[model samples]
Target: MESNGTGGEANAPENLLGTSPGASSLRSRTESECSDKLARFVLPSMDGSPPKVLTLNEVGDVLKNIQNMELVHEIAINPEFKFEPYEPPENSLERRIKDIMHKAFWDVLRGQLNENPPCYDHAIQLLAEIKDCFPQIISQNNTRALQHINEILDIDVIKQQAEEGVLDFRAYANFVIHLMAKSCAPARDELVRQLTEIEDVVDTFKNILETMALMKLDMVNYLLDFARNDIMANSVEYEKKKFKEYLEYYKFGFPATENWLKNSCIHDANNKPCSPEQTISNAYMELMDWDESKEFPEVLSIDKERILKLGQRAKRLCTCAAVISICSGVPVISQRTENRVALAKQIDIILQGTTNEKELLDSIENVWLQVKTVINEYLQKEDQPVIDANTEDMLKSQIMQTGNKDSPVRTLMWKRFQTYFRLAMRSRAGLPPPPPGYADFKDELEAYCTALKRVIAYNHSVFGEYFMKVLTQQRVTSTDTTTSAAAAAASATESVEPVSSSAAAVTEEKSVNSQ
Candidate 1:
């Protein structure tokens, strides 16, 4: 048997063979149908070009678009979709949170100011105020520099430039600074030289002031001693009158004689002396000539009052010095007396108005510490005796009046002294000595610290603790009820609830039912 031209097998004759050809052709047709079905679903490009295989990114984009379309369809169909207005909390918690934030911001600003003080705004304001004062400090030749400063300070021009965002004042500020520095160069150099020349100017000044105070005391004492001696010697009226006159003149000046005669003598209603007895009395009194009687004469009256006044003044000054010494951590009493004498001389020079700024600057170097130490030591040694004597007189008077041995007055005085002494000692203890040959206007530092303490009575540690407590208190109070409720719920769930098998089974059943 022979095959046909189209490769189709011919049917077998009645007497011929066994296999069918259609089975092979059926398998090939099934494969072709599957390929055609797949080709029918292939997508074409937007430009009507042949279909191209999509990349992974393009497929992801198509999936995202389909998800967006489904979301839009769901929103359109849903009837419960409603936009709600957002409501702000109406409670103290919001206010408290704001306050805490405000406090924190101010604290940070304060710290910044402390770290780098004299900020640009303050510096500019200061410059404006002291513009006129600069002329006196600087030389006439610096007029051009002054003009430049004035030009730079023009508010209108500055504002215009600032609006245009081209304002740059740094160069102008630097120029002014350099000019002023140059102008003050001579004064600054002079001060520096004096500081270098003087070994310890502050110590010298303190010593001088202390010695002058002591000398004043000694002079008064000598006057008293002379008066006592004259009275004991039974000096002649002429000599006594002369001594009395000197005391009166010293205490009250020349007007004392006229005033005393007019007041003490017998006078007419017109206040004029009329009798010879009045004249004699006036003459003798004016001369301060008087015999000491059992009552003790009034010849030394003015001197006594003057002494008391001087003593009180000295005591007050000593007290102030002692306080400053304790605060400054410097010993007032130096080992050497020569330093005290030098200090006294320097003070005299200053009082005479002959001392220039350079000399004054030199004396001011570490002055607070030096003055404190010197005054403290002087009070301890010299002024203490006077204070004790005064205190004794007061005690005597109180005793005579109340007849009480244990008075509250005495206790109060004792307590004050104890406190003062304790503070003084504490200030001195463990303080390092100032560096050798180092000098500056330490009084400025003392003044600054005093001002700071006046404003803020509490120390840094106390202030910090208080500030933190305030912030924490606010934070605690500001915590919302919702947060508290949530915390409470969590605690309750943890304490009493356990994940038992029965509970788990119940939860699963509910989920299955919901599904």
Candidate 2:
């Protein structure tokens, strides 16, 4: 959450904005945008002002995270998610000014009351302002509380009491505090107690107002949470309906999905006919090894971040497995505690530091030192120098070979994982076990499997029909083209001498078939 100098916190009061992406902007709009006091104010701005500035990142985070969320569903799923209170940085100019202004305001009121007969002017305004806060805290449905509050703090009635010399300003503050205790969240019970600790009328009123600001936020969050819970409870189906409508309006116009699936089909080392099941699995794999410049298929936007992270983690696993294979070749260590395995894992970390291939290639030059450092650290722990000068050269030479795309260890491990993934995509009752040499990466592979299954299952639920139609259409086109080409070749192989106009007709027929 980015904090500006204005003392605002990002993603404030979830209910202030609509739960869906199409909903207009958030925290709360000013009176210019909304007319009703309650409608205009769900949660007060960070400075208790009319409008709050939500940063770009904050807005993006809110929209992206809630883009597919059914607010009702989110609340149902986790009603306990806390909405943090906004507080300006203590050293910020806004906080300093607020503190100064609040103190000065309280001081004037205190000074007025300390005068010859106690002016009561500022006190009356403060009471009126405090009176307005009742609607902010208590629900409109709680008419009993609202009616009682209105009668007790009515400015007209208070003025009469002041003229009659019977108005108790301190009593009104105490009454507001008592009402606040009943209105606040269970979490704020301690704040009500602290307000009681301040005996000075001015000090008590000052803290009471500040505490009310906080309690208002708590009430807003609580209300927001309640609304969101009901929203989330039914959000899943609502989201599906919205997504279907979105697709239908565009005619499920997913050229990106088509391109992604087609590209995955062509990824064989040898140009062979790709199966549809394998194509889907390969497409998922492509997302993992996806090029950064290319946009992800829009249909998978919900799982975009998850797939990317999973891909990176999966890559790290494969690379580590390969490194383990490479490490065994170097004559660098004692056979006691699996030092080669430790070295491999550490080396994979360096190699997978970033997604940038060039960066990793550049860093490959220093991998030897890293490898040495890791081994030396382990060796020192065991009271031995596992890598000496000769061993360092051998380990560095073998380790650096991993930078080559064709390195035997790298190729072997990658191919094994790919085959395992392809097999994992199968739906048949009995299937082949994962390829050998994956035990070292079993945990990562399992995690990848779980994440991939979730994406595949949900995506298929939403898009299975479209994918099937597209794939079936593509298959039919390929078959017709292949059959036409084969028939053309077969006819061309036969002798067809020109035997007059009849031969001309035959030749024309052949030409049509060939074309």
Candidate 3:
């Protein structure tokens, strides 16, 4: 074949730019640029090629790495044979298949969790993705899977995970639901039931999942959702550039998979299959179904903005609540008390370098160490006379008056205080507020406030009677300045013009005579 100048063939300089038309130099430069691009674009596929062909022994080693997922096994055993032969199943067969798949999936997850609770995070994630893609398969696969799914539902494992005060299952489940809606449809009943269960759990983890998901989703959608419905829209505005580029890619028909995993910060390029890192990333990516690219957009600019907002809000609320808790006569320690102040200072020391994202997420426990010191300080005052008196009175008058020892208000008060105190310390740096109506986050605020109040109350009950005595004495010495002002006003009125009332007096006398 005759060689074209496309490959690295030496061109005759006389026939190239040297002897061509006026724009020949430009054309030559363009060709050179094109060649450079081709060199970068079409290298040997060392990095991108498929796995090398395995020898018989190597294949056995590979098979050993395969996870024996029960759900996968159950699906493989489907008698409907539609997946293999592409036959349409009858309604009964479809239903049976889905039922079996769902049960098997949950059973596998439960087995995984029981085998190792640490793996529950990975197991929940896989189950959710499987449910999302093959909802139909899950629906009609097998009845056995439903029983296991019900067992998870029965033990309220997901809820327990949340109640245990973590986000492992809840986050996994949420991401799954998100993937399902954006990628495929989940079974209507199953989705609804799981969502309802989620609603009953802690909102903090829910907020975390949703907030993190929105961050992964991008800020433009978040802003657009907010603009369209200001009342219900709740997302931070970090990563707008990244999000905007992502939107552009979407418009250009790019898939959403790789970007989602990339934004989540969980993707691992080195592992595959059963490794949670790979499984989680692949599951979400499969839902999104997009190819990876190096020239993708950067929608990550809003991270600091949202984190700042959340951090500042948390801090201000804690300050206000700390003050109010101290003033409410609820028997709490003063936040500024020497020991408490010292602890706050320690928090300030940590806060000097920490990020709002860290504080809002409460991933840093050192913040809580200072808070615990304050709590311990308050607890030590329980034996003091004033505290003893108040406790005794509270037990006798209020506690005895109620049929139940724990009233909702009191229970919530204590719980709310604990939450608030924890939050105050955990997020001393602050977090951005969620979208509106999300104001119910005040429940969390209330909880945080209550903890501070408890600390204050404990201290005040010990030392508050003396403080109240000092205040009463000060009040006794203070003059009734308002009453004095009123008397002076009356005297001034008497000294002013007397003739103004003459017409009024005549009218009054005439009225009396007529009566």
Candidate 4:
């Protein structure tokens, strides 16, 4: 392959000397230029004195070492080796083998980079090429892998840093090595299986693996150090990059209809002057003023953007209701005009202080508890005869209980109420009513809400599961340490007892003889 002009093989002595007769002068010129370039590639020593310039011989040796390393890497991931079928080792053996293989891989990588720093670019390129050998290594799709790579090695950032002469090639190389290991896991596993099967080479493989694992860890530390320094040095710039990426996924500004609530209050159905508060208050009242002849308003909407906004509002309302009910020890009356007014006021207050998505979601969870309370109350009343208004109020006052906040029933009720509240509010006076084919739109909206809830719930559950796993691991580790310590103490006591008994026996014998 032709040199990439970054001083790979182009400056090799053999390449420089092996020129045509007519190009003897050109060869000498090239040699002189290469020597000058090699001199400029001065690496600083640990003692931080004068930088050490590479001699032609040292450069040749470095290039040779890099070539040999690349050759070994290629051989390790050879198609023939990867395709060789072999029985996997037993579970215990497999774990050991895996650990060893990882160590070996990383050790070689670290040494290769440290010895020949200029080979960093080639090493990274080789890793990218090797990734293609094991297509099934990463669980995520290729697109996602590309996106992850792009994020870590943003080309713009690289260019900017390079121009500024502050680019850390070693850190970048470590990151690439880490990625290569990850991408080559399947291939490595296969190779490990084959190696472990061979008794003669097992020890060598284990040694290699151990080295690689240690090197991989070092690489991780190095990358982390780089990130720490970079963040500390350019905090604002780092944050700007992060924020720019986040904005690409989620829009920053509120929707166009963000003022829907305010607008609802300003105009009546006829576009006449009206009290926005009163209009909103009456809309809540109309939720319970259901007529037997009039069909229920479509509970779904097709306009996803609009529905999303409505969902946000509904979530806010639910949260406000929950907080109020929890704090005041009052059963949230969804239909009462006064309650709706109170909810709106609470929502306003909540919104005023809310600064992030997390806060908003937390608020919604609070309201979800109240919804659960109401649902449970209704379920309990299912078998009982219809109580009079006064009797119902008495029952509510006496028996209303705040159940487990994380109850599944609460989540279900919360979801149902989310849809109901969104539909009801959207149909409010002065607001745009559900468009034509409202029924289908309502179905679509409900589906959208259900899917959204599922995604949120799934994410929450994943985090919860991870947290539990970490706690369990910590507990297990603590228990193991305690048990080991106890066992050691007991063993020590047993050993000391024997010695004590022997000493006592000797003393008794001596005493008897003396007597």
Candidate 5:
């Protein structure tokens, strides 16, 4: 048995699909949720800020990529998607899996090929599977490659070659690689090279299978890119149909949406009724104040993860901006924009994936060093005197306190950011300017707001009719129940008159006896 070398895949994370920074998993979003309506995503903030549970539409730009995707199976139009080098999983479970997959299967095939008289049973099946991949990856117009595949990988000829002592596995592999090299896109040239250069027969074939998997992805993505224009053109109607099917499902409905809208609706200073659009927009904006204990409104649930991730992104920026605000409070770095940005980026890198105070404090020890370094760079660039030990100690003392939520500067900036969100949400006409002090997070706020507003406008345009239909039905049912209860109460009040009449007669008799 030959040893096949390997590596693992890197997780390609996004807030969600599409160019909008509201991240979502295109694949994951297609799943039906607990409400079993549309798929929902959970956006856990990297910093200690609150987790946002949102829906796929809330992720924004997904529908723009969500059309005629193999009739809703395996196509995505992600502008940000990139082809990355393949690496196999590196964990203990994956090691066991790798052993079973490669050691047990490929080794058995190799062992069978090298056995007395050469068994063609397993080899033929393996070749058959490999044969299937060619048609999947290549075009029908490439008649030369198709004809070559038939000649080389023909099961009858391969079986006959095995019957004689003349089977050459390397010849089949070389021939396939020759065609793969020709067919593969430029991005996959390296993969094709890796497939060609592997010396061991088993390694060569394993690399072949791996490279083919990547090639198929490359082809699909290329197809997706080519098809993206068509996808965007037709996405709205396709998404509407799919969402209608979800709504039509007997068990699935937007039970939470009616209440979410009803609760989030507000009156102006004059107590005038808000327009329906205002009502819906206000409801979506209220998601920023989400409570973890409750479920997201069903309408928003599908994009729950994307919306939350966008919120998380916004929160992460705010958190980082606050830290920079604190670090730069030393006057030298505070006055300079570059120093704050550089220092904040370094701190964010250090603080990545931290979800709470304890985890945050663990990394604070290194932040002081980042702060000092950034300050020194700024001073050197500007030809200012470098900081003394007293200044360094003062900066370190200030920086370390950021691990706490109440670090005064951090809290102050956070409050300003919160104020900004509320002010933005209050009303477009009467929207107040953002609270000052957290200006560094302005870009984050803008990006999140843009994605949210876009998602809201697009989602409402597509689904508002359906939303109103459900809301109307729910309201009618509620009003009917209320009317029935009022009728029952009125009947009980009519029956109570007899008891009052009897009490009145008893009081008259008592009054006559006393006279």
Candidate 6:
């Protein structure tokens, strides 16, 4: 019993066809039966048995037939789709799959125009079912898979496959080109190309996709710093305007924080007499590294006005830090001023302590802790609560009555009068210009600062006073509506102007007269 590897049926040729032994299978079997058998038996070869060999040529012809079925099915259904390989016993499966696919493509080229939706529908259904059962087809069948496929067919097998399917490969390709030209919208050109170049289509796509991904990553890396810079630039534009307004208001509060890392306190705390220029240089370097200088708001919501109040506050602290820098140096000139470094440390604490929501919250909190220590020891004598409460109340009142009452303006003027008067008092007695170093200046920057403070504080105070005065006058005028109402109104108007002017003049005079 010599087993001629023909496992189909021991008597397949004899039993199925009435004619005996060796009639050519391709010519004898009806195309439909061969196709049905191929789909039912050979195509779905998942059973663990080795497939019975038809004559090698016979098998090739059968595969070629199956390819036509697949394509006609695909076209009637997914006419646009190319057949992907199948799975299971990976290498063998792919070889069988590529044989069928190659024939189908050839058939499509050979003028098998399938416009019928039913065939298309069945092909779509069949391919989808096959795909579900065998998702790893191509991935499983790599280079070696192609070699195995070549073992089964002629290098020219694809050409014959196309010929038998009645396809003209070149004409089909040109037809595809014509169809793409006719397409009015973005079409699946790449997918068509993949199908046309079936053997290495997946490999090429993989490379293209990889290259595109790398390009995207490179672009993002290049733009990361720019994005960060844009954020900072926007912040600076907004913040600078606010700072300018704050400078106009002349309330210096937040100097320390903006340059904290520069002050040598963080880096060289034990060293005495740090050079101011050197300290500034070091801090500037640190600032250059920050990606957020432009990101701070131009005006902070300190009480509600869009004054660069946050920056002003920071500037104040910076100045205090500057004073520390000066003091830290003072130990060299006067042994008595050896304690200035410590005093500088105290100033750092005070400046760090004052803060609000938009302030760099953590830094402010940390600085405040230092300030608290200083306050606990040295500033114990000053009535911090009283001064703070007074300033806060005055500021709030000025804001509330900004346009509502001219009295708010008058109250500000009166406050200015008081500030100039105090400075004048300080100057007439010649009492060392408020400690540290207020003496060395021709523009009289200190006097100007003092005058500006007077102006702001006066605006705050006089407004409150005049608001109350007008309120009283209104009550009196309402009840006693005759002559006193007009007189009181006239007096209030005359008094407000003279007062604000006199106050401003006094402030300027004190500025000059004191210096």
Question: Could you give the C-alpha RMSD of every candidate to the true structure, in order shown?
Answer: 46.2, 11.8, 32.3, 33.2, 12.7, 34.8
Give the per-residue lDDT of model 4 (tens digit) for 385-432: 333566445434322221223434334435555445355444534223
Top of the candidates by lDDT: 2
- Ranking 2 against 5 by TM-score, winner: 5
Model 4 — TM-score against the truth? 0.17
Query: Each prediction's TM-score against the native?
Result: 0.19, 0.55, 0.17, 0.17, 0.64, 0.17
Off by over 4 Å in 2: 1-239, 266-275, 324-355, 358-370, 380-383, 400-408, 420-445, 480-515
Write down the lDDT that model 1 would get. Answer: 0.36
TM-score for candidate 3, residues paired by index: 0.17
Lowest-lDDT window of 10 residues in candidate 5? 1-10
Taking the tens digit of each residue's C-alpha lDDT, what string does model 5 give over 1-515? Answer: 00111111111112111112342333244544433236565554434555555464443322233323223322222334445655567777867776677778887877886788777687678788889999868987888879889988999998888888688888888988998998898988887987877888777888888888888888777777777768756766676776654332212234456667776657689864466566666676666546556656655544576667665555455657666766656666677776666666677787777654577677777777777777888788879888898877876777677666678766776677666665665557744554554455555557666566555655675578876675566557767987999999999889998998999999999999999
Residue-wise C-alpha lDDT for candidate 1, range 1-515, written one tens digit per residue: 12112212332110011112221211123335534322222223334455444333333333343333322322322223323333346667877786677566445534432443213343233335445444444445777976866686665565565456554444444444444445543424443233233343233222322333333344444444545544323323333343333232122222332333334446588854454334333433222112222221133232323323332322222222222222222223243345444443333332232123233234333343344344446667654422244543442344232112133433343334333323332353432222211112123223322332221221122123323343344345544555788899999888757765569889999999999
The global C-alpha lDDT for each of the candidates, from Candidate 1 onward, is 0.36, 0.66, 0.37, 0.42, 0.65, 0.36
Clash tally for model 1: 7
List candidate 6 segments past 4 Å from native: 1-361, 364-432, 435-451, 457-515
Residue 213 of model 5, lDDT score = 87
Error of 1 at 483 (Å): 99
The per-residue C-alpha lDDT of model 2 at residue 157 equals: 88
What is the per-residue lDDT of model 6 for residues 1-515, given as tens digits with 9 covering 90 to 100? 01323345433322211221232233234446445243222211223444343344554343333333322322322212333333446468777887688566535523333433112222223223322322122223355643443343222443444445543334433332343223212333454344345443223323333333333343343444345445333433333333333223222222233224224323356633344444433332332123243322111112122223432442333344333333233223124343444555454454454444234333433343443344334434444332245543443343233212134343443343334334543463432343233222212334434433332332233223323343344446544774677889888989798888999999999999989
